[model samples]
Target: MRINRLIYHEGKVTNPYSVAPTSHFFGSTSQSDPLFWFVYACGPLPHTRGYLLFGSTLLSGWPVSTVHRKEASRFVPSSVRFFSFHYLSSASSFLHPLKMEFKKPATVLNLANIRQALVRMEDTVVFSFIERSQFYESPSVYAPNKYKIPNFSGSFLDWLLLQNEKTHSLVRRYESPDETPFFPDQLEESFLPSLNYPPVLADYADEVNVNDEIRTVYIEKIVPQIAAKRGDQDENIGSTACADVDCLQALSRRVHFGKFVAEAKFQNEMAHYTNLIRNKDIKGIEEAITDSAVEAKILERLIAKGHAYGTDPTLRYSQNPQSKVQPEAIAKIYKEVVIPLTKKVEVEYLLRRLGDDDEAEAQDPQRKTQLMNRLLSNSLW
Candidate 1:
């Protein structure tokens, strides 16, 4: 079946030209049926009017720029759009400089765009795991008061993380909605000017911080599995804290990405989520947002990435080339911890979504707090 729907996004237009099994850009197919996908965006940028098409088939007659449709070869008058023809398989996809402008909600909030960003983040999370694996568990790094600081009462890692956050906050790291700080209570204001990003989520989006849960699971569940071996290395304590910070931030961003997923899903299916939230159907809301197929694909893709990235490319000819971190273990962490926590954030965000409506009874201060606590407590993974 061919799809010719035009998707309009904040002055931008995306048209999925067609789907066909025989087309060639990149695609997968089974014997019984062939699945194909192609999408292109034509829109305005500050300094350019550009177009980009991503798909398995190169169908002619689609617009390549602000130019009229059907002129795929004709370039735009003032802006030059270079087209990159390539295949994008999970195993062979290469990393490049990706600039996802958040200046507008259109470029930033689209599910397709969000998916691209998430895929890039997987590389980061995997690389961070490999880095941390170079050292032992470094238990001293996490043990409280292991390193004495005059005013600090937490672990060496905590002190380092707080310092890291405070420094980055100056450049407005936390200003980005996807960033959730472990020490949210103490983040300093930015010295830089505000980005004034167009608001994309509900006002209560900031309250959906689950870094507490993310950190707990990372320390108790993930770190041990991915590290070199159990036990602390006194000399490597500092390096360990830094590496652990990277892993936590990557995981935090990935898990908290649920906000974007939830907002996108809620906006796309407002009526369904509205009903679930209005009736306090937590289970139903979770079911509606959950896509088992996508989740499975994510696990499978991550497993491949873990093996691909964790191994040395030069050692391809080596017998039984071992990856620094096990591919299956990465998938397992995502399946059990990352995916569930993301969904939890989605559910919590949706429950309070109606708070945007002034008429909703959830606006009562005490009632809202009590209700959220009760809901969150009962909704444990």
Candidate 2:
């Protein structure tokens, strides 16, 4: 049967007549909120007549109205079925094409897929480090209030990042689950249509950002080790800052990919992670998730990549190939910083696995049940 019409029922507990025109959009944030409905068409439908169908945004191929659930039930033909709110969002996938297909079971959510993604990101980080090594350690870029631009009081790099975030936000870059902006507070809504990427991580996954710490480590540790020399260059301040942004964004994404890793691990062994989370055993959770052997492999792989990509094949210095950034320094970075931060993210994400929402959803019985159901549905998506 071809279903054409789609009427949304707000399902409010109040009298339908009392529904004065208030907000046009109804996006409920909590599970305990009154359930909504999507009344799909079966056959010929009655006219909306606009009787108490107030405060609703218009829907195409269907009446632009919100009816009481009981009133909505009157049009419930054999084809109509109840779906969770998450399903309502998922259904939007049909209208607005999925931009980031990270929700599928066989695609983005698994450990194997995540590992491949992480490996690719390593290449970006290595290349970025090599690029940054072209410039001297431009201390002016990181110094406070180094470039005095109107209405902004921060480092040159900070100002650049803010402008970059604002520009990217216009095209909806931050809407993608994998992206997290350093200047989150200043980001504006996209001029483009909303792309409802099917949920892959927790609702609060964005909050698990470690960009601040990443920037700190990059300046304090990574730059000093990877830069060409100790002197600051006046000519390369902008170029150096630009390269820093690239490295920071890459590192941020690589580290935060741990969220998906954590989610996949938690789903595979729910009971094990659940008990660990419940016990507040941070050490226990860390040990269970840690694979020292895997870490060693990553370090070895990164050193090899640095040697390959950081050096010119045709060139040699002495008996050894001349490299842009020292291969050992690259290995040392993963061993000291990237791996540890990733583990921190995994542990934090796992610890919040049992929470009601990301911040606090445990005490609410209904929210907990809904959370479990949502996680299962997302895993099966």
Candidate 3:
């Protein structure tokens, strides 16, 4: 706990003061007394507790600049020195107070702990080097300066490259099958067969319900391709499809502007009819409108009526003499009623075709070409 100086020579005690009794104790000594007394003492006590204690305190008392060299020369070479001075009762008792007053001594580390520490240290050093380089040098020199450390050996760069390569590979693996060419480009044509609507009178017959039949025909012939096109459009639009008008417009342009225009007209007609039914004076009309079967039947009847007017140019003229249908009235009827209905039917048919192809693609493990040739075929140019 304290440093004290004593001098013993050849079993005889020496007291420089000369005023003390011949007892074991000596009077207080000055700074000069220890040096004079130690000269006569045994040649520097080597490898002893007293020698170590004397040497450490002596070296520490000197200026810091001289301490290392002085201590190295005095202490035996490679001799490990363990300081054991206790101001506390036990190690455990000292821990709490030591923790409160100073940083805790780190526990002895094993190989794994050392490895982890080294990794963390390496990361810290790398980040520090990057920060310093960025602070002092031009951005262009950052990479070269970062890799220029003498001991770096490029292992870190190699590890980083390996990690990046692995991440890229994982991303590619999860990518859509269509992206990786699972189906041939020509196979897209075979997925759906195209049919032309002949301009025949039977095709436009009053009894002939071509809406459902047309829908079915389109579905059977063209749905798959539409679905494929839809998937491609979805990719083009990304997840923000609905919100992005520019993207939707681009996709619409790619598909067919005419198709979209027709569909819009059809939707307007359906909405008009829906409004008419809701506002109708007929009792139980609301209930009938709500009924899926009733709505379907009503829609079928309207569609048939609309087809008759659309197909038969001769019958389209007003037969009543008292109530002459004006050209404007006829145009309005077609614009507000017939054109919209036809558009709705066509749009619904196109959508159904797309849906069927989507379902097929989902079920089929082998990715068939999931893009529409129509996009390429129906170019505006």
TM-score of each: 0.74, 0.68, 0.15
| Candidate 3 residue 298 C-alpha distance from true site, Å | 26
Deviation (Å) of 266 in candidate 2: 0.4
| Ten contiguous residues with the weakest lDDT in model 1 | 88-97
Per-residue alpha-carbon lDDT of model 3 for 161-270, expressed as tens digits? 33433443344421211111111121222222333322111111222123333223322332222121222232332222122222212222212222322222322233
Candidate 1 C-alpha lDDT tens digits along 83-132: 23222111011111123455545444456667778888989998999999
| RMSD versus native structure for model 2 | 17.0
lDDT against the true structure, each candidate:
0.69, 0.70, 0.26
Candidate 3 residue runs with Cα over 4 Å from true position: 1-325, 354-356, 360-381
lDDT of 2 at 79: 41
lDDT of 2 by residue, 354-373 (tens): 66553354343466467555
> Which residue pairs in candidate 2 have backbone atoms (N, alpha carbon, C) closer than 3 angstroms, thus clashing?
356-361, 356-362, 357-361
Best by lDDT: 2
